[model samples]
Target chain A: MNLKIALLGGDGVGPEVLAQAVKCLQSVEVTFNHHFTFSPALVGATAIDQTGNPLPDETLEICKNSNAVLFGAIGDPKYDNDPIAKVRPEQGLLKLRKELGLFSNIRPVRVYPSLIDRSPLKKEIISGVDFTIYRELTGGIYFGEKKLNEKGTVASDLCEYSEKEISRMAHLAFKAAKNRRKKVTLIDKANVLETSRLWRKVVTRIGESYPEIELDFLFVDNAAMQMILNPAQFDVILTNNMFGDIISDEASVITGSIGLLASASVGTDFAMFEPIHGSYPQATGLDIANPIAAILSAAMLIEHHGLNEEAQAIYMAVENAIINNVVTSDLNPDSRFGTDYVGNYIANSIVDTD
Target chain B: MNLKIALLGGDGVGPEVLAQAVKCLQSVEVTFNHHFTFSPALVGATAIDQTGNPLPDETLEICKNSNAVLFGAIGDPKYDNDPIAKVRPEQGLLKLRKELGLFSNIRPVRVYPSLIDRSPLKKEIISGVDFTIYRELTGGIYFGEKKLNEKGTVASDLCEYSEKEISRMAHLAFKAAKNRRKKVTLIDKANVLETSRLWRKVVTRIGESYPEIELDFLFVDNAAMQMILNPAQFDVILTNNMFGDIISDEASVITGSIGLLASASVGTDFAMFEPIHGSYPQATGLDIANPIAAILSAAMLIEHHGLNEEAQAIYMAVENAIINNVVTSDLNPDSRFGTDYVGNYIANSIVDTD
Candidate 1:
């Protein structure tokens, strides 16, 4: 099969990481009898610098034409340090999500035995933790109308959500649960938030349609505790965009590093796979940034493409590489970094040895 | 100085826990030569069964007349199973908060040395984890418009916040930072929610008032990770209701048991103190529910009243009791029990030791 993949190497170490992702794709292609066409695009601070638009027309076109988009990372300290910058790096990424109608951000947390000790959680606590979180990508207060009223001393943000938005995500969450351990935990603040009450009522009504799966509604507070306490009990956690972003990152460390987690934003006709970690501008060009997250995101892309065998192959190779100590300084900061060198190593393992 | 304290030992193991709290108050009174009158009232499921109103007129009158209120656990599984029930136990608590205009909930998370191992987090990660969370109460989506759509297939809730609502909380948070570590992390989802952006902008404006205090904004997601990775980095975490609830509970277990935390909900004219743990209906009448949280809330109440000596005395007694292995089963479940017995032991220690 021939696949056209959109490559979005946003800002910071994004380019360095994408180079490694390309190598992984090359290795996968060589071994799997498949062909991949790579098209590069910009969507972060770098894009703003070049085209004056973080997510420019050329970039969107590339992504629209591709079977899937592989995002590296975004943001820059320049924009981060300067709070008043009108055109920011994050805007591009958020725009892409909304434009593409990417409604669910899927973040999977799985502890690798080799790095369990690195987790802040005790071994017993984090040992068997494995779960996937589906965060609503485009709705809730993030996309709401924001304003500064009465000479800027006063500010307000209107958070409004339609039932259609809730229905679409609920469908995805329900589908994911059907594939997982047959349990779905909808995390919301229904007890307090009107939005959450709406969430509960919608999800609960939809829940009746799926009796085979156990549906549980948790106030976000309890969900946060349960995430760290008994992570094994969870299969798929469905929540709003904000809840997902926070919980996913919190759940990220349960596995290892924020730099080691990957997420896929799925829409009606487009899918964007990216490492959930932000652009570490400090680490740009330092080859020490962990590429495993990007590499794993590629693995997710493969699986999403219905190439489970190829996806499983990449996962196995990546897992083996970690077990064998072919890692970057981000994972083991004490060691010297072969940043892209680690990706090359994993790619080599996938093709040479496997 | 004399104070009127209204005590409501609601339902389940509520009365037993209140007994211990009363004892601790008496102990503090003796140590500081401070006298306070205690008037007990009924609330929660207990009140519902007796008077058909979770927050009875008598209970409200007592709480309103008193200088402060001490609340034990509430809820009954009977109500939990019946989601459609018009009268429920939690309603009383929520009503108390709304009626009294308890606008800020302060949950203090302190890692007890002896129980550090009880946490799912590594001892090193949690040993020095001390932070206080202030959640915006009586506002946000809790009071927003909730509607079930025409098809009954969609449910939606609205989350709204004005600048004025957030300003008061921001002032309190910045002031807290100045008093403690001079650093405050505001947890919100500015990236996604307009409400969150409103939070950030208002807090940022209020922060100008406290130039000496270092203030930073964190997306709720990143804050969640930082909470586990570097909890000591946080002194005062201020956020809206839902986010605070999630993060606070998440912070609770990192210190120890959910049964080992206390909180205070304060407004202009009134305050309510309660253990962070929910009413463990299963443990009701078993005399095994830990009362330290309730006891600790009393300590907080004393501190609020400027009875520092009395507060410190109660705290030392609770700590010393824990040190001496005189705790309820929740703390050391294997051998600890007779929740009443644990309360009595702590109360006795409060008197005999000092």
Candidate 2:
């Protein structure tokens, strides 16, 4: 099979880690005898510097025409420090998601047994922890109407939700649960917010269609606690945009090695894959940043394309690298391997395997 | 000092643990030569069943007239399972907070060294973790205007913030910092919401008044990750109501002992202290629920009243109990101590001390 993938290396260590992902992808192509075409595009801080537009017309055009997008992290301290900055690198990713109608963000939180000692949590709590969160990407307060009064005394952000928006993500979460542990826990603040109540109503209604799946509800506050106390009890977590952002990031820590976590955002016809971590500008050229997240992102990208065997091969190689202690300083502070070395080692492992 | 306290033991294990807290308070009264006048009131599920109102008018009157309020947990499975229940126990606490103008929630996440092994996180990460989160209460999305469309297909909740609200909590957090590590970290999603921007502006301006303290900013998503990766890095966390509810709960797990955690919500003239955990209905009247949270709440109650010596005595007693392994079943699965036994032990420890 032949496919075209858009590569958006946003800023900082983005390009460095993304380069390793591409290297591993190339190895997968050779091992599987598949042809994958890659197109690079400008985004985030680098894009802002080049064209003064985070998501330029040409970049969107490339992504719209591609089969899948593999993104590097975005953000720069320059924009972060100036809270009033009119344009930021994050706008690029948000605009792209809105443009491509990427409504569902899938973050798979899995604990690697070998790295359990790195976790702050007890091993028993996180040993068998494996769950996926389906977060609504394009709706909720993030996209709601925001206002600042004339006197700047009062500011308000609207959190609006419609049945259509809730139903779309609910269907995706329930469907995914059918293939996994068949349990869907909807996280919302229904006790206080009408938007949350609407979420419960719509999700509960949609859940009826999936009789085989177990459905439950938890307030977002309690859900946050459960994520740390008993994460293994969850199979699938479905929540709004804001709650999803906070909960998924909180859950990311359960994996111990955040550098190994990967995420996928999907719509009906478009999907984008990326590491959950942000651009660490301080480590841009250090060659010490972990590339495992980006490599796993590539694996998710192919898995979305229905190449299960090829994706599993990439996953296996990355797992082998970790098991063999071939990683950047993030996992092992004294490890001798650099970013490129880990990527090259994983790629070699892929080709060396059956 | 003569103080009048209102005790609201709401439901389930509420009464069980509260009894122990009162016992310890009595011990403090004798040890410190302070007269604490106690008044009992019904609230939450028990109140709803007896008075047909979660926060009875009489209960509110008692809290309004008292020097401080000491609360046990609230919530019952019967009410939790029914998503559409109009009359609920939580409404009572919400109403009390609004009526008394309890606008700031202070949750101090402290890791007890003896129970560091109970944490899911590695001991090294949580050993010296001690931070307090100043969450703005009675404002933001929780108390904002909520509306459902005519067909109930769409719902909206407003997240509004004012300079007065943000400034009020900023001063408290900064003042608290002066007594601690002299650092404040404000968590908000300023890039996405206008309200968050307003928070940044107001907080930044307030930060100028305190040149001695270090001030930093983190988006809520990143703050969630930092809570686990480096909780000890934070001395004071200032955030909005919703963000506080979620992040504080997430921080609660870092302590590894939710039953031992305590919280205080304060306004200019009114304040309430309570355990961070909810009423476990299953453990109602079982005499096995941990009372340390409730006991520590009494400690906060005295601390709030400017009785530092008395509060310190209570804190010392509770610490001794934990270090000596005199805890309920929650902390030690095989422990034979019941709720009353632990409470009696703590009270006796207080009297036995200098």
Candidate 3:
């Protein structure tokens, strides 16, 4: 099988860590006897410097014409300090998501046995914790119309949602639940927000079609606390965009393994995978940044395409790397492997696998 | 000194737990030699049952005439199951807040030394965690104009904030920081939402006035993660209504002692204190309900009235109760103490103290 993969290594350590993902993918290509054509495109700060546009039209064109997109990270400090700047690196990614019609974000948070002790939570609480968050990406407060009065004293943002928008994601969650834990927990502030009422109405109607899957509701505040108290109880979490942004990030920290988390922003015809960690600009050239998250992201991309065995090989390689202690300083300060060494080790692990 | 207190022990365990608070407050009055008059009023589910109104004019009048209000929890499962109910038990609290002009909500999350092990987080992470969240109560998306489109398919809620709203809360937070850790962290999603940008601008400007206190900013997502990773790092957290509701609750659970959290909602001329826990309708008539939160709320009400020594006495008595293992079932299952027993023990401890 031949696949077209677009690589958008944004800024800072994005290019460095993304290189490791590319190497691992190449190894998978060799072991699986599959053809993967790689296309490099500019985005974020790098694109802004070269073409004066954080997400160039050409880059979007390449992504549109690809089977899947492998994204690095985006953002730079210069853009961060300038709060009023009209153009920013994050806008590039947001626009690309809109342009690509990617409306749902899938983040899988699983506690690895080896890293359980690293988590802030007790081992007993997070031991068997494995859950995926399905967050609506396109149609919440983030994309709503924003306005500031002429005097600049008052500012407002609209949070709007439609049944069609919610049912699209609700169907996905219920479908996923049927394959996994068969439980869906919808998080919202339904007690207060009108939009949340609409969510409850729509999601409940959609949930009826999937009777085999159990459905429940939790207010966002209680859900935030539940994520810490009993994270194991959750199977699949569905929430609006803003709530998703906050809760997913909260879920990421409890696992105590930011370097191993991967996420995918998917649409009807397109899907993009990337590490959940941001680009470590300080370690851009230091060769100490962890590449495991990037590697696992590649695994997600493989799994997204239904390459089950190929994805399993990548997962096994990652597990082996942890067991063998071939990781960056973030995971193990005493480790001798650099970023390149760990990447190569994982790639070789893939090649050496039967 | 003489004072008038209104007790609105609305539905469920609200009345049961509030009785414990009243006992402790009476002890404070006796020990401090202060004249106190107590008034009872109807609100919430009980109010709806008696007066057919959640927040009756008579109850509002009583609260208005009182110097301080001691509120127990509200809400009932019956109202919870009815989504389209025109009147809710919570609407009473919202109306009271608006009627009394209460806008700033203060919730302090502190980890007691004896209860450190009860938390899900490691002792090292939460041992010294102490922070107060100053949440804007009367504004933001909760109170914003909500609308459903003509077809009823589209729903929207507006989140608006004025500089005046941000500055009022900022001043209070900064002032409190000066008396505590001298640091304030403003949490918002400025990069995505335009209102957040306004928050940054207004807060940064106000922060400039306080040359001593250090002001920093964090995206709401990062703030959520930090609450679990390192809650001790926060001194005073100031945020808008929505973000505050989520993060404050997140912070509360990190202490691993939900039965011990207390909160206060303050305005220019009025204030109300209550336990952060809701009215557990199932635990209504049971003696198993914990009263520490309600008792601590009484302590907060005293503190709000400038009775520092009296408030400290209540705190010390509660601390002693925890030390001597006189807590309810929520804190220790094996301990033989009912809600009234724990409340009586704390009151006696206060009376016995020098």
Candidate 4:
């Protein structure tokens, strides 16, 4: 098998943690006898510093020409702190998503048995929790036409959705559900917003194609509450961009392992995987940032390309590391392990596996 | 003191639970020696069934004429289950808020010491979880202009905010914070939305006037995660209507007492108090619905009218009832006490107080 993977180590601890994922991928290549090429591209604040453009033209080209892209993280405090800054690091990732046509952001949240006690929720409530969120990207209010009156006293943002957009993500959610629990909960405010009504109508039609999968609906507010009260009940949660941003983030913390969550964003012909955690600007060069999320993202990248066995090998290695408490300070505060040690440990585990 | 109260027992268990609140209020009148007039009106599905209107003109007239309005729950499963129904039980509430200019919706989430064990979150995360959410009502996405394209394939909803809308709620939140921990966290998506940036600009200026109050900002997504990860860190959360609806609901469950949560919607000239819980259509005639929320709303109504001592008395009596285990089945599953019993016990506790 031959694969070309684009690496976008955006900013802060991104490059540091992403290097660990590369080591694991190299180990996979050695053990599985696969030919893999890695293409490194600059993005976010790093790109801005060198090229003055968050998403340089060459970076997008490399990503477009790859089998899949494995992203580390984006954002920088220097840009975040200045409210008046014209160009931002996040705009780079947003542009990359748009340019690559990556429209569905899928995040899976599962409670690891070894870390169940670390969660804010009771062990009984979150013990068996396993769910994925299929979020519609590239549409909705985030990309909507924004307006401010001449006097600057009134401001507005439009939240728009097309049947095409709704059905695409709905199909993805249904497809994912077919392989898992066979249930999909569409989170929207159908009773209030016209867009939500359209979501319900379109998703309902999509559900018919996958007759074996069960379809249900929950208002966003109730979904937020239910996520805490009984997170185990959910299988696949499909929602629009804004609601998805809130719900997925809320779901991330429930597992007590934000550092271990990974996400995949895909379109018709392109896919990108990344850790859900932001670039920890404070942990830059400190060698203390967790690398499991990035390593798992590398696993998702392989899984996206139908390399299931290879992906599972990486997953098993990561799980072994977690169970043995070989982690950075974030997971085990008393541990003296650094980012390199954890990454090298997981990579060696993957290679050493029969 | 003399007062006139409008009671709108809306739908399902609304009337039943409201009857309990009225009993407690009657006890307050007897003990505090206040003259009060009670006027009952119809709203929600009951109003739709009886008068063919959710918010009848006569009901609005009664509410406007009264000094304050104490509302019961709203909505019915019949109306909710029918997606095409033009008139909904919730339309009454939205219309009433608009007509009365109720621009601020305030919900206080407090963890009751007696109900700590019921919380889904570990005790350490929820203990001392006392915060108030000041949600800007009568504006934003829910009330925004909505459009479904001619082809019925596209839909959009506008989220608009004016300086006035943001400032009024900012003042309420800041004022509340002055009486609280003197910190206000504004939740908005300022990083992406033009409206949120406007919110930040306006709220930041408002914060200057509140020199003693500390101000901070959090994106809605981060705010949702923080609400669960560390709920006690918040003193007052000020946000737009949509975020408030979701965050307040999320905050409600953390206390493990959604049935005991109360809310107040107020304007310069009019005020309305109601339980945050919806009318449980399934529990309509079962005599199992919790009345504590409605009773607490009655307490807030008195507080709104400058009856602090009287309100505190009601709070103390309700707390005593909860402490003594005189609660409905919702709070104590083993107890055989029904809604009527809990209501009578709290009412008697109020009257017997020294």
Q: After superposition, how far is residue A27 of candidate 1 from its true place, in Å?
A: 1.7
Instruction: Quote the lDDT for B8 in model 4.
Output: 95
* DockQ of the two-chain complex in candidate 2: 0.80
> Which scores better on DockQ, 1 or 3?
3
Q: What is the C-alpha lDDT of each candidate?
A: 0.83, 0.91, 0.92, 0.94
User: What is residue A318's positional error in candidate 2, in angstroms?
Assistant: 1.4
The regions of model 1 sitting more than 4 angstroms off are A82-84, A151-155, A192-194, A197-212, A334-337, A351-354, B148-156, B174-179, B191-194, B197-213, B334-337, B351-354
Predicted complex 1: CAPRI docking category = medium
Taking the tens digit of each residue's C-alpha lDDT, what string does model 3 give over B179-252? 78999999999988988999999999999999999998999999999998989999999999999999998998
Q: What lDDT score goes with residue B269 in model 2?
A: 92
- Candidate DockQ values, in order, are 0.57, 0.80, 0.88, 0.90
lDDT of 2 by residue, B1-354 (tens): 899999999999988888889999899888878798889999999998999999999999999899999999899888889989889999899889889999999998888888988887778888899899999987899989999989999999999999999999999999989988999999999979999999999999999999899999999999988888888899999999999999998898877888899999999999999998889898888788999999999988988788777788888888888898999988999899999998999998885344
- Ranking of predictions according to DockQ: 4, 3, 2, 1
- Candidate with best DockQ: 4
Off by over 4 Å in 2: A48-53, A75-89, A282-287, A351-354, B48-51, B75-87, B351-354
Interface RMSD of each: 2.7, 0.9, 0.6, 0.4
> Which candidate tops lDDT?
4
CAPRI grade of model 2: high
lDDT, residue A40, model 1 = 91
Worst 10 residues of 4 chain A by lDDT: A345-354
Model 4: lDDT of residue A118: 90
Per-residue accuracy of model 4 over A116-176 as CA lDDT, tens digit each: 9999999989989989999998899999999999999999999999999999899999999
